[model samples]
Target: MPQSPPTISPTFRLATQIEAILYLKGQPLSLDAIADCAGCDRETAEDALIELMDDYAHRDSALEVVEMPSGYSLQLRSSFQNLIQNLVPAELGTGALRTLAAIALKNPLLQTELIELRGSSAYQQVQELVELGLVRKRRQAEGRSFWLEVTEKFHQYFEVDELSLILAQSPKHNGTAAITEEE
Candidate 1:
């Protein structure tokens, strides 16, 4: 008779299944969703989640399992943020990205100046960037227009010093026109 393969326990299988689901989703998942996807009960899924979290905490892995009100997600540890940023850039639309680049290159830019450089569509782009938490707007003292600046989130996301290095190599950074438009 052929030797039979050893069977894995239900708890171990559920934990591995939950880890795979979280990895594939690349986003937070609710306990209900995890249980449904893993074909297990909520209690089983919770046990698996806790096990996975403990596993990650005890391992030499660069990733961590986080539980938020929205759900649970696997994410890189904060210490690896600078390294990860160089590998994976933010996923912004072209218009919003261009506006972000312009803002970063010329920080503390006035709203009127941005409009002058990129046209009225900049208003919508700025709104989108602000919503994304990559840009901040403050009212100018002398005018109704706002002054736009990149936020700390932007720096953390993109590695601001790396941006400066890239910008320095670009020819556009040379002799860039001054924002002379009246506020």
Candidate 2:
């Protein structure tokens, strides 16, 4: 007899899609983010998350979906976590990383400009980056907004000497970020 592929119900498929996003992100994502990435609506994404969590609860798996104060993520089930100790590097939340990327790409970017580029949330991410020593912030001598830039720690931590490769590969976010502009 020939082998047959296992069939997945639409709900189960949606759950798997959410699973992929959570795994790839390695960070918590809200219902809206999950839905946007999954090509579904918030309600549908919520249902999918529930289904996925239920599936994990019933399976003998090392990983499980969890809800954090920030949002939803996939992580090693509590009991199995010791197996991954020191395996994963400390990570920034997705939002903070995105803000850092914007600042790095636009070296010596202005805080005001960063806010415009990354939305109001950039304020918090910038503060976090500064506290981590990956970014530096200083009062603008000529303006109210501060100046922002990546620190040596950033280059070392990310292990890249030149950003030209990254520059060549990325397009502006939604074609709106002024990453190509000459300041």
Candidate 3:
């Protein structure tokens, strides 16, 4: 009989696959998606996720697995946030930057007001920001309009308080008060 290579256990294989999927996606992934990608059942996927989470937790690694409302994601631990942020350059474009600045300056801003202030392009900017995990949109109580607010991720990524100080000191915003303040 010919010699054969040893086989990997399903649990180990599924755990490896799930880790790769989460790493590549860079976002939360539902259990169903993990199972589909790993070619395993839901129970297997859930087990793999738990295994991965525990593995990361026990290790002294800077990264961790987190469960969000949307799904599960692999990310740097809060303690490592500043260190990683310093290494990665910001990826926001000019339009997105402007939109974010506007929102950060006047958070809980109504979508209507944003559109009026930043033009129709604000819609696309908002979408991009949301995808980047920097902004969140919620339906307004009174109308079909949405309320735009910066998310915790935004604060983590940009250190909003620092940005706010910079913006306040900027000549452009020095004399200009927040739109909400005017009303």
Candidate 4:
């Protein structure tokens, strides 16, 4: 006889699991997709989804799970919008953002290739990015071309680390309190 798939945990509803998966994937998933994943009917899945939504209705969090007409997705919560905006240096303008976006999307791209893709202004923008410590230059032995990589600081600012590992590294109130106690 064929073995059945393992049962899902009851601690959090199937929809909550779906939400966690969506957040980790950083993309939206349809009801059918979520139901298929959670091994439940659409109605039960949606009911669980509603309950999960209620759980996240109003509280401070970096991200929130939301359901759109097409699918469900996890996104940065609006309350932390300012925090995100502050993370990036104000000196970096739209041109810099576009340049960074291009570089990040096509990482390890050559400086010449980036210039060709982003135009002549990219050279100056790249220099600026280098000064800002957002991008680094790496030599590509294949063609002796230099490529840019995002720095650890950039990752911290973005809270990427698969889930705010940056925040985890920072000194928290409890940590400071312990230090004071030792003193």
**TM-score of every candidate relative to the true structure:** 0.49, 0.48, 0.48, 0.45
- Clash pairs, model 1 backbone: none
Report lDDT per candidate: 0.81, 0.83, 0.83, 0.72
- Candidate 4 lDDT for residue 176: 31
Error of 1 at 183 (Å): 30
Which of the two, 2 or 4, has more lDDT? 2
**Displacement of the residue 69 alpha carbon in candidate 3, Å:** 0.5
Give the worst 10-residue stretch by lDDT in candidate 2.
Answer: 174-183
Residues 1-183 of candidate 2 have per-residue lDDT tens digits of 954423435554888878988998988999998888777779998998999999999999999998999999899888976666446534799999999988888778899998887899989899899988889998999979898989888988899776656666557443324455643
Q: How far does residue 85 in candidate 4 sit from its true spot (Å)?
A: 3.2
Candidate 1 stretches greater than 4 Å from native: 1-12, 93-124, 127-183
Compared with the true structure, the alpha-carbon lDDT of candidate 4 equals: 0.72
Off by over 4 Å in 4: 1-7, 58-62, 88-183
In what order do the candidates fall by TM-score, top score first? 1, 3, 2, 4
* RMSD of each predicted structure: 10.0, 9.5, 11.9, 14.2
- Tens-place lDDT per residue, model 4, 1-183, is 965434668797575687766766666889877776777888887887787777677756677778778798887777777976577454568998899867765555689888878899998998888887778998887887797877776667655653233333556524333423432
What local lDDT score does residue 40 receive in model 2, on the 0 to 100 scale?
74
Reference-based lDDT, residue 115, model 4 = 83
Residue-level lDDT for 53 in candidate 3: 94
